[model samples]
Target: MRFSLIMVAGIALAACSPPVPDSGQGVGFGNYEEYQKQQRARDAQLAGSALPPATAVSQETLAADGTVVASNDGSDLAAETQAALGQGQSGSGAATAAGGTGPQPEAVYSSGISQENNFDAVGAQRSIESDAAKIAQNRAQYKVIEAEALPARPGGDGPNIVDYALATTHPMGTQVYRRIGVNLDGKAARNCAKYASPDQAQSAFLSKGGPQRDRMGLDPDGDGYACGWDPGPFRKAVGG
Candidate 1:
């Protein structure tokens, strides 16, 4: 019984020893040390195999209300920025908002100018031209001084048909003679009833008006003639 017990103990001890190597055709697998080396290689392969969680860096951004936030990655970045900043423009039109269009305000204009120039519209050249044209046109029309001739009235001692008192003695028998620039002639003078030499008549009329036959004894050298009338004053001066 003691020898049988010794053999069983020896068998149990061999069974408890480290596992043996595996030998296939020519290769051999060793014990725990080889297993440890294989474990280390497997750890390295796992480290290389698992892709490192994709590394990324994020930039910080500011919000409209001054708070910090992540930046947006969308395509409409500029539009978003404008909206957040409240910087968009509004008006009747784009041109009007930019101050580029529309009717201009009125400006004050004046007529008088100080400088001298040939083309000045408000100057003397225009006035002279207008006057010259008016005068030229007037000369072209038939404007005359004496329009027509008048006949002399017969005067004589034959019944003295023309009354000295009743007849109005205005020259040419018309008050139109008072107006200036008229062409007076001898025919107009013969219409007067009483005969006074032209000078005496004119002088007497200028002094007091009408016949002054009695006053100056104007009929001095007259043979029933008046106003120094052998030769009248004007004719005597001219020796006519």
Candidate 2:
């Protein structure tokens, strides 16, 4: 009976305790030094098995004379290019005979100006005597236009504002004429709105008893000008 009770107590204690985890089966809690040694061995093996060195490539280029040459030297390439240009310029006739239809050297470098119409070319071709003759011919064709008085303002009853502007020497806001009425400025503002521009307002004012009289009230300040119109520009035009 005592032996059986001891055996039963040992079995119960084993069952109550957690089971021990296998290091190889789950997350390894094994030798870190061993793992490092394995890694170092793998790196060394990879280093020893590196790929072979690449072979040097020899590049060949075609020369201008239709021959394949090794382009190892830069000087050789530049010499070949210069030789090609010289051959093209010197042997253009030979190339044309061999079925080449490219533009001639002259056409390629031409300034696009025809020799006949170019001023420098024409000047080179002309003699001093010829130039003097041409100048005389041109002068003979030219005519001197006599300055005539601008034909008296084509007879119109309505006063020409151009004439009025030229006639008036007074500067703006000089009050050349007399103005008397209630709210003359307000009347002018309202009346000026009816015209498109100050010039139009002045023209209309002149036609309907303006300058001397303020029938339309466009010239509120009695300056002979209407709707803030200035005669200075017109006066200046004639050098008045």
TM-score of each: 0.19, 0.49
Clashing pairs in 1: 218-227
Point out where model 1 deviates above 4 Å. 1-119, 123-131, 146-149, 154-240
Off by over 4 Å in 2: 1-124, 147-156
- Model 2 residue 10 CA deviation in Å: 28
Candidate 1, residues 94-156, lDDT tens digits: the string is: 657478776468998866655564356556456878989998998899667875544555763
- Could you tell me the lDDT of residue 122 within candidate 2? 87
Instruction: Write model 2 residue lDDT over 50-89, tens digit each, in one string.
Output: 9656875445677669898887656776787798899989
Cα-lDDT of candidate 2: 0.83
Model 2, residue pairs in steric clash: none
State the C-alpha lDDT per candidate.
Answer: 0.47, 0.83
Error of 2 at 68 (Å): 24
